[model samples]
Target: MKKIFISILILLSLAIASIVPFFKSVVIEDGKTGKSLAFFDAKQGSEFSIEYIHSIHKTPVREIYQVHNEEILQTEMRFQEFGVGMPSGADEGEVFAQKGENYILSNMKRTFPSLDIRIGQIIANHTLLLKGHEYPFSGLSEKGSWVSIKVDNLNIWQRLIGGKKLG
Candidate 1:
C-alpha cells in the first residue's frame, strides 16, 4: 500500500507541474500589428486573457477598447509615451492605465523618430481595473514596450524603424 501511494503521489505531482505553465502562457495572434491580440492555449475556465502588441514610430493613434461578450468594455484612448493620452469617443469611464496612475511613463517620440518593438509578456495582477473597478487586465509593460510619433508628417527614424500599423 505504501509503495502504491508513493507512486500515485509522484504521478499527481508531475501532472500538476506540467499543467500550470500552460495556463500562464499568454499568446497574441496577429501579433505583428494591434489587430487581434489574444491569449493562446488558454484554459477553458480562465477568467481573463492577456494581450501584448508592440508597434513603434508613427503608429496611428486610434481608439483602444476591449471586446467582451459582444459588447465594448471601455472607451478608446491614445497611447503615447508609455501612458494614456487624450481619449477618443464618448466617456466610458477609467481604464487600467488611468487607474494605475503611478506607472513610470515615457515617450519614444521626443528624441528618436521611432521606437523598437520587442517581445511582449503578460501576467495576472489584481491592481488592473476596467472602469475604476478591479478586474482582469492585459497590462502593457513600460520597459519592454515602445512607441513613436510623427514629426512634420515624416518619421525621424524612417530608415531605422518603419511606420507603425494599426488595426
Candidate 2:
C-alpha cells in the first residue's frame, strides 16, 4: 500500500508539472459559439491582422490588411484543425467560409484600392492540417468569397506549438 501510494503521488506531480506551462498561454473564450480560444498567430508579414482559436482540431487563421501602402495585393484566410485528419467527408470543410464571413468584418476594404481573395486551401504545415484546398491568387480586385479551412491531422502537435515553420 505504501509503495502504491507513493507511485501515484509521483505520477500526479508529473502530470501537473507538464500541464502548468501549457495553461500559461493566453486563452480567449468566444462566448458566442461556446468555443474556447487558445493559441494564435498572424501571418509573418502583414499589418492590421489577427487570428485566434477557431476550433478544437484546427488553428485559427487571420489575414492582415495592408491598406496604408495602397498596393494591389491578395489576402487569404487560412484555417486548420488539429487532432483530426484531413477533411474526408464530402461536406466536412464547407461551412467555415460562411462562418468567416459571419464573424470576420473589418473596414479593411474601404481603405485598400484592390483586394483579390482566393479563399479555400488545405495547406499542411508542420503544425496545421489544412482542409478545403483552393488555388493561389495573384493581382488585386474587389472580389471576395467564403472558404472553409479545417484540420488535416492532430498527430502533429509539436509542429503547431510555435506555429508551423517551413524547412
- Stretches of candidate 2 off by over 4 Å are 18-34, 41-48, 51-167
Tens-place lDDT digits, model 2, residues 46-93: 233333343445565554343233231223344444234323222322
lDDT for position 72 in model 2:
19
Flag regions of model 1 displaced more than 4 Å.
Answer: 20-25, 30-59, 62-76, 79-167
Instruction: Give the distance in Å from residue 143's predicted Cα in candidate 1 to where it truly belongs.
Output: 24
> What would the per-residue lDDT of candidate 1 be over residues 47-100, giving only the tens digit for each residue?
221123224332223232333322223233343335234333232333334334
| Estimated TM-score for each candidate | 0.24, 0.22
Model 2 sits at a Cα RMSD from the real structure of 17.7
lDDT against the true structure, each candidate: 0.30, 0.32
Specify the poorest-scoring 10-residue window by lDDT in model 1.
147-156
Best by lDDT: 2
